[model samples]
Target: MPKLARTIRFDESDAQVFSRPAEAGEWAIPGGFEFSNWTEGDLSGKARQAFANGWLSLESFGRATLVAVAQVEEAELEPLARRLADHFVQLYGAPDAEAALPIAREEIAYMVELCADHSPNVLLAVSRELTEAGVRESFRAITPAEAEIDLVAIHGSAD
Candidate 1:
């Protein structure tokens, strides 16, 4: 699994950095971060829906690692991508500064471009550490391959 870290800037004074395990589809949010009410199952359900609708791509399904290297606002994202974006904002807070590295800036730019595509096949994974609540929430937009696996797991048949 490939790993990448990026700082998400919500504003000039608030920001949070996150690292993700891309292949495993998990986010490691450090303790002390807080966000609105959300559950792992809720995120999973959304991801499943995205997969069923063919919104997430195979290459990005569980492979793309995104680290918040810059601050992004809900206003900055397209309508469809807002749910996840807002979730991040509510949880980690918005980004506060420009990306620290050229690659990070490029990645953020890429994400912005992808969000504009509005394709259901594009997957997004987000997570946070809520140590105070004694819970950690992770979510992702599911991929076609994962949807097939889920189908097989449920029906016990490829058909």
Candidate 2:
């Protein structure tokens, strides 16, 4: 069977807002982060911390890592892509950040169930959107505390 494409996920953590301090000391817009991914074991703990600091988790369905942090809803496609990548990262955690990666079948199913309600097909249409957005890679890299996401183009359409 052909390898399954990276499943999409949804995370509120991706959205955030912060104000820059103009003077030496100033109060800014007290920013925050949101996201969704698949994290487990020790890494899950870290992800929890990341969440406290501002990060979310979810899981992916197959190979091909696709990451994204959505900010603007140019449309539904961008958010859809981020959701898929978040799913995998949340479930497996960052292999580079953590020593061991955890893969749980049941957990994966649960996550899919949770996010499947958001997108049934899992961003297949969004992939085309990313292509149109001029994003060569379907994946959008997202950081723990950092805000903002790389959006993909809609196939055959220019933004």
Candidate 3:
């Protein structure tokens, strides 16, 4: 597996209002891939609007970058991430990670939408790589508990 850094930026205003300060070693799942080495800040603002609804105003509130493992070569991750990010912007607008305190499970559905709308081709490519690595069957056989552990390890949360 190759360790890939996926970079995602949100308007600093959105970051301030919506996102938590990423812990030093936190993982960010901006789209489908997991990113570590997260760097977040209240940087600056630029106008960003949803392609679909256009109701949400988005801007560059903060920026984050994290490392993740990918089955593909490291070189491929960036382009793949770019495609996914574009897809996310098109499908559900940019991420607004803000949620009320005591965050409810259902409140973060936007994140799920982001992940799901990320490039299907990238997902298929990753799947092919996993199958080639001989872990596809094992992944398929994972118990719910094991799956939870895996998700937490990669995403830093089970929620």
lDDT of all predictions, in order shown? 0.33, 0.27, 0.27
Ranking by TM-score: 1, 3, 2
Q: Which of the numbered candidates is closest to the native, going by highest lDDT?
A: 1
Native-to-model Cα distance after best TM-score fit, residue 114 in candidate 2, in Å: 0.9
Q: lDDT tens digits, residues 1-159, model 2? A: 111223222322222211111221111110111223222332344333332332112221211112221222225333434453454466545443222223223333333333333322233211211123232212223333333343232234355
lDDT of 3 by residue, 1-159 (tens): 333222222223324433333322222233221111112221223211111001111122122322122233545444444544543455445563232211222222333333343321121111111223232211012223433443324333456
Off by over 4 Å in 1: 1-102, 119-146, 149-159
Q: After superposition, how far is residue 12 of candidate 3 from its true place, in Å?
A: 45
lDDT of 1 by residue, 1-159 (tens): 122222221122111111121332222122112223444444353332222221111122221222222233545333323333444444445552222233233443455543443343334445444345654545454454655443224333457
Model 2 reaches what TM-score against the true structure?
0.20
On TM-score, the leading prediction is 1
Candidate 3 local lDDT, residue 134? 31
lDDT, model 1, position 123 = 42
